[model samples]
Every structure is written in structure tokens, then in C-alpha cells.
Target: MLEDDPFHAELVGSWLRAAGHTCTVTESGEAFIRQLGRESFDLLILDWVIPDIAGDEVLARVRTMLSDMPPVMFVTSRDSEVEIAMILRAGGDDYMVKPARKLELLARVEALGRRRSAGENDIIEAEPYRIDTAARTLFMHGEPVVLTNTEFELARYLFRNVGRMLSRGHLLESIWGRSANVNTRTVDTYLSRLRKKLSLGPETGWRLSAIYQHGYRLEHMGIRSREGAAAAE
Candidate 1:
């Protein structure tokens, strides 16, 4: 853990040890960088608001230093939609808002550990859909669906926040990394394309819906099978 706050660091260290993890706590980016030069760890938990150097910078440096580093869990107090999106785009594996529950912290840590152990790259699956982040290809119902980089990022963001309604600003900043250059129209254009590609059908419970001026959400309609059409008939 790289956190400047002693209390927070000790609490997290205590939790990790209780969970049977061998953890080391450090208070500054300089120390962390020096430690990285001498020791290797299974995973890293970084505080977003750390002093001396920002947590995002630490992650970026770590990536360059280590050919293969473990997953990272960002501990942040900023819950702004834009901040979270920025963190995710900066290559952070996952995030947790500050003052987090003990269980939630542990759960996020364990999840990070699992992803590290699995040695999986950018490929991910959510039900019948398969996304190869590296190949920049998506597969739905065994059919190939091509997507532009923007469309892919938009879909991936919505999919990651499934069942949650993101605001327009949140979507724009997350997908584009900043809102100064674009508007919600860009988000809508890509969303239309993603929906056309996903094509959940009546049998499948999956659907994407726009929440008025807010943002889009991925939903499971709870309907399944081609028989669903017959039942409706």
C-alpha cells in the first residue's frame, strides 16, 4: 500500500494481513519507486490523493519499470464521475472510494488478486458477448461485430457499469477522457452503434436503455430463449 496517511495505511495493512496476504506499506511515491527497485509484490493498493507524487503517476511509472506487474486497486476519496473514469482510463484495474467498508476493501483486493493469478489480459466476457480488448473485436451470438475505437470504449464503459445510470458528463469524460472537446451527441452516436451490434433479442434479458438527459445503462430484461417470442405471441 502506498498511502501518506498513517492511519489508513495501517488499517489496510492490518486487513491484508488478516486475509493472509503479505503486505508492505509505504508513505510516499519516492519510497515506493525505491522499493520497487529492490522488491516485488503480489499486488499494489494506491491512494489516489497521495502526497509527493500522484497515484496515477505511480501506476504509469510502475508499468514502465516492470514488464508484468500485478493488478492495482486505487483507493480514492474523490467519487466524481469524471475522476473515476479518468482513473479507469489511466490503466487502473479497479477503484474504491475512501472510508470504504472493511469487507468491500477486502473484496476488491481479493478480486484484484484473482485477476492477477488468472493471468488474463484485456479479454473479458459478460454472458453471450465476448470482447477482445487487444484485438479490438466484439463477438455477439457467435457473429463477428466490428467497432471503432470510440464505439468500443463507449460500450465497454457502459458494460462495466451495467445496471447503473451514468450521467452525460460522466459518459463523455470517461469515453473521451475530457468533456471540453465533445458533447453528449458523440456518446449517443456511438451508443446507437453498440446497441445495433449487441442485438440481445427478445429471448435474452440483455438490453441497453438511455435514461433521458442522463446516460445509458446496460440491463438484463430477464427474458430468455426464442420461446420468449412464442410466449409473447
Candidate 2:
């Protein structure tokens, strides 16, 4: 979700969680666009007004960015009939006027999500990591990396949710089944193996950072090096 207001961002994020949805919030349009360029989401929630870019402009850019456009909803302070119609005509799937009631917001979100496209290509590509979903094979820097099914799933999940803090319980239930007789230690052990096997280190431009009490997040740090170079110049 792209929201500038701190209170609204927090409230909407909590509501989305309550509806069993994972949301990543951005306070500025620049950050929002950067994230969309790298990460994929099932649905989007936008506010009409933003700091760096207008919400409507972001909606339009999202349409042009992806071959398969995901559902986008507008949650703004505007309540006018014309504004609502404009949002819809501008590629927004749903619109809710703020302050959005909990039940109503969730309902609108759920409705938009029901129409989400499930069709995905067999190949998944992120920089330096290429995943062939159909073959269950992964390549790092164009070289094949042997991975067990479980390990592959973990890697794919991490890439899919880059920068999002995933808890141990969530990882276990997601990668290993809930019924699997594995503790959080299993998660740590595998992550360590991946960190070594995938060369997830500072020099490699990526980090599988372990957060205390939280789990891990796959952070792309390539930008830091570029920023450092620019500063030196």
C-alpha cells in the first residue's frame, strides 16, 4: 500500500493483516515505484495524494509496467462521485473513501482479490537468480545450482518476498508444512546453508539478513554500492 499519512498507513496495514493479506507499505511514491519495479504483489492499495507522485499516476504506471496488471484499489479521502468514477476509469479496480471502515475496506479488498489472475509464466527471473518453475531448477548467475525441493521452495519464497520480514512460524508453515516435525531451528539451519551455497554476502550485493525475534529478509544491497560510487564522484 502507498499511503503518506502515518495513522492511515498503520490502520490500513493492520486491517489487511486481519483479512489474511500480506501488505508492504510505502510512504512515498519514489519508494513505491522502486518496489513495484522489483517486487510483485497480488493486489495494490493506493491513496489519491502522495508525496512524490500522485496515486492516480502510480496506478497508470503500474498498468504500463507489467504485462499482467494486478488488481489495484484506491483508498483516499475523496468521496465525490466524479472522483470515484475517475479512479475506476484510470485502471483502479476498487475505490474506498477514507477514513475507511474496517468491514467495508476488507470487503472491497476481498472482492478485488477474488478476480486476481493466477496465470504465471513457467520461468521466474530476479537479478542473478533465475527460477524455472516447471523444471523445479534454479540458476544463479547463469550457472545451475543444485537444490533439494524444500531448499528450492525456501529460496523461491525468499525471492518472492524480498524485504518483507517473515517470522519463523510463517516460514515453517509456508516452506515446511504445518504438520512437518520441524522447529524454527530447521529454518535457521537451512538459511545458513543457503547463505553459503548462494553466496548471500555483502560483496555479492544481497543479504539474507536475520532479524532478532523476527526471521529473515532477502535484501538487495546493490544500490548501496552505486550510491557510494556517486558520493565519491
Candidate 3:
């Protein structure tokens, strides 16, 4: 966590530690960038205004330097629409207004942590599909499936959370690294591409179901009941 205010830093750090996460709090953006260079982190909680440099500038630098950039959340008093848009455009995964509630903060942190954990394994297998994380490749039925970098990441995330309803916001945050100021239509477009490319349907025993007013779930076709089928239809 990069926070200039000592009190806020300690408060946030304690909250994270209580949730069983190890956290390092930095008082300046310069120190935060230095720590990032020395160590890798799963998530970053940043304050927009810092002593040495602004958080957005630090985020830009991090993006340029790191290939696998960690999830970043901005927690700051600056809650204007313009500021929020700018921060998200600059690569923040999530944005929170200052004096964050403990429960919401913990929830967001846990969500980001889950995304990181899901991505750590080098190889992932879901029956006919095999994913090679190191090479960023996907294979199905012993045959290779060509996927762009974004498409591969999206497929991996979906496979990792199979059977769970994943909100478009969650997918956007986990894959694109920005939760706010993004068009959910982008997710719809990708899902369409994935469904076509991977042959996801009843024939394959896998179905990506879009829940009305909710989100999407990747699940086995057999598990969906007749009523569920009717509703989906």
C-alpha cells in the first residue's frame, strides 16, 4: 500500500494483515516504486496524491517496466469524475473513494488476491482444454488453439473460475486491469469470440451461460436443469 498519511496507511495495513495478507506500506510514491522494483506483489493499493510523485505517474511507470503488472486500486480523497476517469485510463484496476469502508476494502482485496492466485499455476487443464501459462498457449483435444494474448488470459480466467458467476466488472478488472470507465460491451465481444473459437456448447459438454441481469458462468452442460435451460432459452 502506498499512502502518504501515516494514520491511513497503518489503518489500511492493519485491515489487510487481519485478513491474512502480508502488506508493506510506503509513505511516498518514490518509495513505493522502489519497493516494486525490489519485490513482486499480487496487488497494489495506491493513494492518488503522494509526496514525491503522483500515483498515476507511478502506475504508468510500473506498467512500462513490468510485463505482468499486478492489480492496482486507487484509494484517494479525489473522487471527481474527471479524476476517476483519468486514473482508470492510466491503468488502475479499481477506484475507491477516501475513507474506505473496511468491509468493501477487504472484499476488493480478496477478489484481487483470488485473481492472482488463479493465475499462478503454470499449466491448467479442464478436460479437453490445456493451458500453458509460461508460453501463453491453449490446446484442445491434443490440438493447439491460436489465441491472442488478451484472449488467452480471458480463457484462462474463465477456466479457473468454472461454474462461478463472474461479473463483467470482475472480468474487466482481472483481465484488462481496469474495473471502472470500461465498456462492458468489450466483454460481450470477447465472449462471442471465445465461444466461436473454442466451440463452447452442449456438444462439447461445456457451456458459457449468460445470466440475465447478472453475469456469465462457464459450467458443464449436464449440470443445468431443464428449468434453467428453459429460462436461458
Listed in order, each prediction's TM-score against the native is 0.51, 0.54, 0.53
Ranking by lDDT: 3, 2, 1
Candidate 2 segments whose C-alpha is farther than 4 A from its true place: 117-233
Off by over 4 Å in 3: 117-233
Question: What digit string (tens of lDDT, one per residue) describes model 1 on residues 1-233?
Answer: 89888988888889888877667889999899877655445578889787789998998998887655668888878889898898888888898898868999888888887876566557768778777777877777667687778888876666655565566666776668642688778778877877776775554457787767456667766645445764877
Candidate ordering by TM-score (highest first): 2, 3, 1
lDDT of 3: 0.83
Q: What's the distance in Å from true for residue 230, model 2?
A: 38
Candidate 2 residue-wise lDDT at 231? 73
**Highest lDDT model number:** 3
RMSD of 1: 15.9
* Residue 79's lDDT in candidate 2: 91
Stretch of 10 with least lDDT, candidate 3: 222-231
Q: Which structure among the candidates has the greatest TM-score?
A: 2
